[model samples]
Target: MTGAFDGLKVVVHVFGKVHDAGDGQGMLCRLDLEGLELVATQHRVEAGASPRTVRFPLRTTEISYGGTDDGKLVLKTPEHILYAERDELEPELKRLGLVSLDHVLSRERQLLGGRRRKGLAVWVAVLAGCIALAFGALWLADWAVARAVDLTPAPWEVQLGQAVLDGQTWDEVTDPEVIEPVGKITERLMAEAGEHPYDFRFKVVRDPQVNAFALPGGGVVIYTGLLENADTPEELAGVLGHEVQHVLWRHSLRGLYDRLKWHVLVAMVLGDISGAQELLLAQAAGLMQLSYGRGMEREADRRGVELLVRAKIDPQGLHDFFGKLSEQEGTPESLTLLSTHPSSRERQEYLKELIEENSGARYQPLDVDWEGLQEKLKGGAGIER
Candidate 1:
C-alpha cells in the first residue's frame, strides 16, 4: 500500500544479520524513506522452514547508526539490532542522506594526492642532488691528484721508487763488467738530460720480456731480452733515452693518477701520511706493470729524441728500433716495451721528422762492448716474463 513512504526514494540491501525481540534471523532489508521505516523480509534460516518478515517503524524508536569501538556499524533500537561492517553500511547510510561520507572521502583524496606529489618532488630533488654530487666528487678528485703529484718531493719520489723496487725480486745486475757499460751510458745520458729530482739508478734485469720501464722515482729497469734484441749501441741508446724521459717527466706517477680515485687521492694528498707509504709502495708492483697512455708515450718519444740529440747519438736509432719491431712476428703487446710505450707509424713519422730537423753527427758508440753483453745474456738464465 502507498503510505507515507511514497514521497522519497527507498534504499534496499541485505543486512548480514538482524535480531529482534522475536529472535528471528536477518533478511534482505529496505529503508522506506517516505514511510520512515526499515523493512526486513524473508527469513528462512533453516531448511524447509517458513520465512518471517518484520517492519521497523522509525516513529516508534529512536533510530540511529554509529560505529562501535571495534569499527562495526550498529543500527539499533531498544527492541532490535541491525549489524554490518562500517564500510558496508556507511555508503548506504550516505545514500540515505543520513551521513556526510562524501565530504570525508573527498577530503581524504585531496590529502593523499597532495602527499604523493610532495613525496615525488622530494625524491626527484634527491636524485638530482646525488648526480651533481657524483660529478663534483670526480672533479675534486682530479684536481687533488694533480696537485699531489706536483707537490711530491724529488727525494720522496726516489724513495718511493726504491721502495717499489725493494718490494719485488728482480735479477739485479751485480757484475761490474756488465754493469760498467750500463753505468756509463746512464751517466752520459743523465749529463745530457740535465739536473733533476731523480738520482737515476739503472738496472739490467735478467728478464726475457724484451721490455724496459721506469719506476716512480729514478729507477730504470732494462730486461736482458731487450738487450738481446738491440742491433747496435745506438739502438740501445735510442730506447734507453725513451725510458729515461719517462722517469724524467714522472709519467709513471701521472699514470698512477688515473687510478687514484677521488676519495683515495684526497686522503693521499691531504693526509700525506708517511705510514701510507707501504700502501702506496704495495701498489708499485701493479704500477710497475702499467703501460703509459698515448700522450705520455708521445712526450717520452719527443723528449727522448732531445736527449739523444744532446748526447750526440743518432736519433734514428730509436726510430729504427720501433720500425723494425713493428715488422716482427708479434703484436705490439707481445713486447712489454712496445705495450708500455705504445708505438705506431705515426710515432715513427714524428720521430723521423724530429730526427731530420735535429739531425747531427753521431757521437761515442754509447762507449760499451755491446756484442759481449749480448753474448753474455745468450747463455744467461734470464728471468721469465
Candidate 2:
C-alpha cells in the first residue's frame, strides 16, 4: 500500500524471538519503516495448512546493518539479528539516505580505538608515579637521617646519654682512688683532642666482661675486666683513646640514626619536633648495647692512634692490647670485647705499621702505678688514691 515500507517485495531470513515471525527462513517480506514493522507475505507452515502471514516490529534507529563475509547483508538489534540478500537490502538502505555499512563500522572502530588509547595513557602515568615514589622514599630516608644527626644540639646528646643511665645501678666503680689514674689518662688524651663541646664523663662498671663502650654526649663506660687485663697504663690509654674518638666522631649517633631513619623522616615531614626528641631520648639507652660497624671501628682506631701520638704515650700499647685480646678464646660472656671489637692479626699489623710510621717521635711513659692498681683489683680491696 506504499503506506510504511515502500511497497517493495524483499526476501529475508529473520532469527530471534520476535512476536509473530518465530524465526522464519527465506520468507518473502515487505519492510514498513513508517510503522516500524516487517510483514511477511509468505512464510513456512505445516504442509496441509494455508500459508501464514507474520509481522515483526522493526526499530530502524537501533538496528545495525553490516555486509557479511558470505556476501549477505546482516542486521543486528537488541531484540533480533536478521539476514537478507545484499541485492534486496542495499537498495532500500540507499533510498532511505542511510550511509553504507562500511562507513558505520569504521566510525565505531575509531571511537573504540580512541577510548583504548586514552585508557592506556592513564595506566602508564599511574605506573610511572608509583616507581618514582618508591625511589624517592629511599633517597629521602638517607638524606633525612643525615640532616637529623647534623641538627641535633650538643646538650640534647648529653641528656640522651644521661637518660640511658638514669635508673640502673651496676655497682659502678665510684672510688676516686681507682678513678684518678683513669681520669688522668683521659685528661691527657683530651688535652690533645682540640676544642670540643662535650663534657666527657668517664665511669668504670664493675662487670667482668673484657669490653668497653662509648655513649653519645661523651659518656665512656669501661669494665673492670678491661682494666684487669691491661699490663700497662699505656695500653689502657690506647683503649681509652679509641673509645674517646668514637665519641668525638659521633659514631653512636650515626648508628642510632640508622635505626631511626624512617621514623626521623616521618617526624621531620610532619614537623613534629617534640615527637622526634622523645623518640631519640627513648631509643638512645640501647646505645650501650649496640655494636659499631667495621668501618666505624677502623676510623676510631686510626684517629685514636693519632691522638696517642699527640699525647706522646706509646701507640704500641694499642697494638699489644689487640694482640692480647686476639689470643683469648671467644667465650661469649667473658670475651665480649673480643666479640664486639673483632680483634684480628690484620688489625694488629695495621697498628704496627702506624706506630712504625711514628717511630721517630719520642715516647714517654704515663706516670701511673699500673702494678698497684691491678693488685688492689686482684685483692678485692676498695681503691683509695
Candidate 3:
C-alpha cells in the first residue's frame, strides 16, 4: 500500500485496540487524509467511539503481526495521530501525502534564493540609473546656460539695468560721502578700461555689507561697506577692476549661461528658446539655484589684476582686498563675499604672484576728476557721504 495518490481529499479508517482515557470510554477512530499521505499508508480500517466499547478504524501502508506478543497498534494520518506500528508505513506515507524532508528543504532554498537575486538586481539597476541621471543633469545645465547667454543681446541687458536704476532717481538713492570716492575711482577705472565693446557703468549702493557684483551687461555695483574698508584708492581700484573684468569677459552672462545650460538643452529639444527664457527668468527671480564655476572666478581675478596693471594702478590692491576678505572668513560679512565670488587664501596668493611678475611693466595713469565725480555721487540719495 505504499503508493502515491493525487487528490484533493482522502478519508482513512484505523482499526486497533482503542480506548478513550477520558470519561473511561471507548471510541472508534476515523481520520480524513489529504494529498500524498493517504496513498502512502498500507492498511485502512473504520471504527467509532462509545461509552462501553470503542472500535477504531485503521488505515496504514504496512502492518506487522506478532504472535503471542502484546504490543500497541497505532495508526498515523497526514495531520495528527502519533502512535503507529508502521515502520514500513513511513516510506508509503511520504510517497503518498506527506512531504519529504529533503524536498521541503530544496523548495524553500530555491524560493528564497530567487527572491534575493531579483531584489539585488533591481536595486543595482536603480542605483546606476540615478548616477547616470545626475551626470546628465549637470552636463545639460552647462550647455543650456552657454547658449542662453549667446542669444541674449548685450544692449538689452544694459537697457534693462539702466531702466531699473533710472526708475529711482539719483537724488532719491545716492549716498553723498561714499558715492564721491567710489565715483571718482570708477571714472578713472572706466577711462582706463577704455572703449571696450561692452558698455560699462558703475553705481554705488548704500549697503554696509562688503560686497561687489557685476551684471550681465557690464553693470557694476560697489557696496559702501567695501569702500569703507578700503584704506587706499589702490584697493578700491583693484576691486573695481575685478568687477570690470567680470563685465568685460561677460562673466555674469557666462554664469547665467552655465546655470541655464541644461534648460537650453531641454528647450532645444523642444524646438524653442522660450522654455529657456522661462528658466532664466526663474533664476533671475532667485527662485532657481545656480552657481558659477571656480574657473570663472579665477579668470576674473587674473583679468582684474591685468586691468589694474594696465591702468598703472597697483595690483597689490586686489591682493590686499582678497586678504582682508579671507581674514573675515566664517563671519557674516564673509558669507556675503561668498555669495558672488569665491574667497580663498590661494587666490590671494596667486594675485600677489601675478603683481610681482608684472611689476616691471607700467602704463600711463588716466587724468580723472576725482573730486568732481565724488561731488556728483555725493549729491545722490543712496550714495552715502
Candidate 4:
C-alpha cells in the first residue's frame, strides 16, 4: 500500500474566511494530505486575490463528525472549520498515516472516559456460575473471544496490524542480502500454510533480544538476535512458521480482544468500524507486549509443525530450537522474550511429540548457505554473535 495514494485529493466545504478572501461560507474546496492545506480556486476567490488557501496542521486540528448522514468530517483548526465527506477523507488520511476522524474522536472520548462496566446482575450470574465450576467461565470467555475473532473482518485485521506497524519506530534491517533469505523461508512456509486473507509481510529489525512477533494482520518482525541464535536456516524457518501461525490463527487479535473484551464488545454492538479501528490503534504497542496462554502457544506450535511437515522441512528444527531455549532458560542468556514464550519442559516435550508424529515424513534441509549467511551477518547488522 506504499505510495498508493500519492497526489490524492478530496473535496471539502470551508465554513470560514481564508484571510481576506470572501466570507468563505460554504465554499467548496480541495484538500490533499501532502500539502497539509486546503485550497480553492474561483469558488470564493476575490477578483484580485490568489486562490483561497488555508494551512491545515494535523497536530493542532481537531477531527469529528457532523452534517448530513454524519459522514462529514469536521476538521476544526484555530482559524476555520473545514468539513468533508468521511468517505472522501478517510482513505487519504490512511495513506498519509493519519488516523481517521472517527478514530480521532474515539481516542479523545476514550481518554476522557472512565472504564465501562457490566450490569451487576450479569456479573453476579457470571461469578456464581464460575464459582460453581472454576474453569467453566474461563472456557466460555475464550469461546466468546474466539467468536469475536471470527466475526472480525479480514480487512479490519489488516488495518489494525498495519496501523500497529506504522506506529512503531524500528531499527529495521533493510539489507536485501540479509533479508532475501528470510523472505524465502517465509514464502516457502506460507506456500504450505494454505490460502489465507493476509498479504503477509516479513520485516527484520536490528535488536539484541532474541525475539520475533507477529501483528494481528500479517506483519511479522524478526529481531536480529533471533537470527544470530538460529543455528541453521531450518531453525529460522521454524521460528517464522510459528509467528506466521499466530497471524493465521488470529492469536494476536484474539489475545488483544480478550484483554479489551468490553471495549471491543461495545464497538461491535454499536456496529462502529472506526470505533474498532480506533481502539486497536490506541493499543498498538500492547500487541507486542502480549503473552499468549498455554493453549494458544500450543496451537501455534502444532500448526507451525504441521506447516514444516507439509513443506517436507524437518520438524526437528523447531524441536531443537525449543530445546536450546530450554537449556538457556536460567543462564545469563535468558531473555524476557522467553517470558512471553516460556520454553518450558512441557513445550519441548510437545514439540518432540510433534516431530515423532511426523517421523514417517521425508525431511530435507533448507537450501541455503547457513554458515556463509551467518558470516555475512556476523560483523554487520549489529549481530552480537
Q: TM-score for all predictions?
A: 0.61, 0.63, 0.59, 0.62
- Predict model 4's lDDT versus the native: 0.73
Ranking by lDDT: 4, 2, 1, 3
Please say which candidate is ahead in lDDT: 2 or 3.
2
Candidate 3 versus the native: TM-score? 0.59
Estimate candidate 3's alpha-carbon lDDT, on a 0 to 1 scale: 0.59
Better of 2 and 3 by TM-score: 2
After superposition on all CA atoms, what RMSD does each candidate show versus the true structure?
A: 10.5, 11.6, 12.9, 27.0
Model 2 CA deviation exceeding 4 Å by range: 1-136, 332-334, 383-385
| Model 4 lDDT, residue 275, Cα | 68
**Which TM-score value belongs to model 2?**
0.63
10 residues in a row with least lDDT, candidate 2: 12-21
TM-score of 1: 0.61
Task: List, in order, the clash count of every candidate structure.
Answer: 4, 2, 53, 0
lDDT of 3 by residue, 80-132 (tens): 33233333333444444454532543454465577668989999999999999
Clashing pairs in 1: 4-34, 5-34, 5-35, 206-383
Which candidate leads the pack in TM-score? 2
Candidate 2 clashes: the total is 2
> What is the descending TM-score order?
2, 4, 1, 3
